[model samples]
Target: MSAPATAAQPSTFSRFLAPVLLVAAMWVIQFVDAVLPLSFTGFGLRSWDLQGLLGIVLGPLLHANWAHLIANTGPLLVLGCLVAVEGAVRFWTVTAFAAVIGGLGTWLFNAPGTLTVGASVLVFGYFGYVVLRVFSPARLAHRLLYAAIALIVIVLYGGAMLGGVFDAAAGVSWQAHLFGAIGGGLAALGGRRRAVSA
Candidate 1:
């Protein structure tokens, strides 16, 4: 008799592909911008400009320079992979929440005509999601596991995350960091509700 089939397993690569693709897109766009005469930063979110509202969707995909993209790359990959541990859907959901909320907050609060671009918003969002996920509804064992992971994340990124929101220097958008974090927290809470209801 043939052995019964076992369930397929998710590969390590598939789990982390989303963040890799995002960073790759940013790099590719930056390359094109560097090679061409045209500038893409103009497409970044501009405070209080009606036409600039489109930046909400495009801003994180663009960056001010190679240095800016490099700075955001590590954190985005690390925290994004952590969030993606839940699944690709969950990963995209948190990203959407962070981008929209972070973008809107930046648009409303920054100086008019001020332009913002970078993946720092998503970086902050993923950080918040990882930290707050400990509070999400789950079985005791699962909650403990999440708590352990959250503690480690906090220890690693806590100081930088705080500085990002409260000690932002000139040219940095603290509003995006703060609101992106709020978006992440909301996603965590939303997960709790879904778990409880189920």
Candidate 2:
């Protein structure tokens, strides 16, 4: 008998699509803001303002500055691609949870009128999902792969991730980091359930 055909790996284009769109959007918004002499940051998550509630949708798209967006781009691509390996559906589901949860947390906990912006919420959330996934009840092989990937992620970003949440410096919203992680955990568990059911 002929050998069974293996499933195809996710295409590079498929993996990169979402992240590229996200990064491109940030850059385009930044470009417009730079040329117009108006800061788009006010559109970010502003605490305690009824109108600021809109930020829950817009926050991740607006960055404080070029430097801020640049800083988040790399981690966003790396971790976002990891999630994308499962396809866009999973990637966006985790992203929605992260942004909504992270944004709400910041809105409730961060100082009123403070403008919180950056893709760090997504970055931290992706980190949480990637790391927590190792402990999920998937097939042994899948879990082992997750464990290896998690270990590598930990060694690279562990300290930074910890500092991001608990040891946040001034101007950083620890609430977003902490809650984004919470959201990521929720996604990981949700994903595991779906996987097992399938």
Candidate 3:
């Protein structure tokens, strides 16, 4: 007798695929940019230029250079996975918020025609979401757990988070960091409202 066909099982790490894909794409883009003689920074977000607005969507995916991407990789994987813990859908959603908010803020605030690029925007977004979420969730157990996690995230990234927005370092886009965080806070509030309604 022929054996029945078996269904494929989902991997435990499937939820992490989105962030993994993001990181992988970053590495690939950097590699290609490095190998080619042409630079890709021109494709990054250009402040106050209508023609450059497309960079809002394109900017996060492009980085200035290997050093920039490398600096962003670790915290991204950590906080990104934290966001992904909700699901891949939420992960991408938060990323969208971060990109748009970060993009618009930088465009409006930075020197006209200035360029910005990198994943730090999403990093700040994810950080804000995780911290803001500590107040949400219906159950005490969940709230407490979130509180603990939030505390840990604070200890680890709090300095960088504050520094990113307030440091005013040369070549840094505090606008991206600030708006990214605002976007993340909005996402958390939106989720809380949904939970309340449901």
Candidate 4:
């Protein structure tokens, strides 16, 4: 008797639907922010304010304006797709870890009274993950990928750091960037072991 037909593997688009849906949901909420005077800041438990918990999950979706949201969407979309490709389980794991750690990093390291906002921390985390994934000793890729990541970091963050030094009001949270990168590094190390085992 013929063996039962195996189910076909889903297409790349199908695999990516989860992240895409999330991105769309974020976009919709951003639009809602434009029209509504809603702020979660005053609604939750006093001890656990907006910046404490909701900020970790919802902060990425809330933006200062269209330009800010646009600035973040591209990197988020690209890196998120790559993470999902690693497998749904790993994708969610990295995302949840990055968001929580990045938020806590902001809470702990940010200057007191400073109102931190935006998804840039998570963006940096995504970049960190990519770097670790490429540079891991067990990865099946050529050395060029690792070199490219190094070059990208130097060209991008290096310039941003130097610029931050001169422009005091640039308002970019280099601390969040730093902590998110560290968080991503830790997550990557854990993920690397899984890759090696696989």
> TM-scores, in order shown?
0.94, 0.91, 0.92, 0.75
lDDT of 3 by residue, 1-198 (tens): 655453343354987888999999989988999999998878889999997889888888889988999999999999999888878888998898888988898899999999999989898989988999886865999889888999999999999899989985899999999998888878877888899889
lDDT of 2 by residue, 1-198 (tens): 655554355666877698778889889999998999678888888899999988888888888888988989988989988888878888999999899999999999888898888899999899999998986887899999999999998898889999998899999889989998888878998888877788
RMSD to native, candidate 3: 3.5
Ranking by TM-score: 1, 3, 2, 4
lDDT of 1 by residue, 105-183 (tens): 9999999999999998999989888888988878889889989998998999999999988899988999989988888
lDDT of each: 0.90, 0.87, 0.88, 0.64
What's model 1's TM-score? 0.94
lDDT of 4: 0.64
* Number of the candidate with higher TM-score, 1 or 4: 1
Q: Which residues of candidate 3, in runs, are more than 4 Å off?
A: 1-11
> Cα deviation in Å at residue 29, candidate 4?
0.8
lDDT score, candidate 2, position 170: 91
**How big is the positional error of residue 84 in model 2, measured in Å on the Cα after superposition?**
0.8
List pairs with backbone clashes in candidate 4: none
Residue-by-residue lDDT tens digits, candidate 4, 164-186: 33452566666666666666667
Q: Model 2, stretches more than 4 Å misplaced?
A: 1-10
Order of models, best lDDT first: 1, 3, 2, 4
